[model samples]
Target: MIFGTCGQRAPSVGESAPAERRKYIEEHFRCISDCDMCGICAVYHNQDPLLVYRDYIEGTRTFEEITEEYRR
Candidate 1:
């Protein structure tokens, strides 16, 4: 249950693999319907967008660093 560059399906590749490797992958960027983005995600929703904008212009942030801050 993994993907690689160009949305390629993982775990089925080698020099001897079949040429039709693309068929093994059904979709790209699957969504999790059960995810409601509550709790911690809610906190991010409240504050992180502004931080993200600041990061873009102010050159003082990164998504991973801010996300790790929220996790802590």
Candidate 2:
């Protein structure tokens, strides 16, 4: 799924995703040194970006569903 300000495709979550998926999620979605170019910090505000996307990364929920929670 495509998420965050970078517009990169997120790694697909599968029924048996390996632990590396977590690293991929963190590296891609979490805040890096270049915060000005990434909008995730603003979207998550004081929340941890990893926590915000936990369900999706765990394959327990869709990215859309998690994002919809914030939209509401």
Candidate 3:
């Protein structure tokens, strides 16, 4: 089973993750600069940021459609 930045997001039904498992997984992502938490997180606190604003602007486009939208 492949997992990356977006893959491990499970829907919140109050199923608390095990402490060690959560720590292990969260450790995979690292800060790019001297700070932790990305820019959107530091400024707007957008905990749930999408991959692109264009995805929302295009309105209900399928993943393939969104992928094609960026290809131009």
Off by over 4 Å in 1: 1-41
**lDDT of model 3 at residue 13?**
19
**Off by more than 4 A, model 3:** 5-17, 34-72
State the displacement of the C-alpha of residue 35, model 3, in Å, after optimal TM-score superposition: 11
Q: Write the per-residue lDDT of candidate 3 for residues 1-72, one digit (tens) a residue.
A: 223255663222134334433342344333455445455345324332243322333333333343344446
- The total number of steric clashes, by the backbone 3 Å criterion, in model 2 comes to 0
Sorted by lDDT (best first), the order is 2, 3, 1
Mind giving the per-residue lDDT tens digits that candidate 2 earns over 1-72? 446445855556664373555666677676665878766767776578678878877788766677777866
TM-score of each: 0.30, 0.61, 0.24
Give candidate 2 regions above 4 Å deviation.
15-18, 33-37
RMSD of 2: 2.8
Residue-level error in angstroms, candidate 2, position 35: 5.2
What TM-score does structure 1 among the candidates reach?
0.30
Question: lDDT of model 1 at residue 14?
Answer: 36
Return the top candidate by lDDT: 2
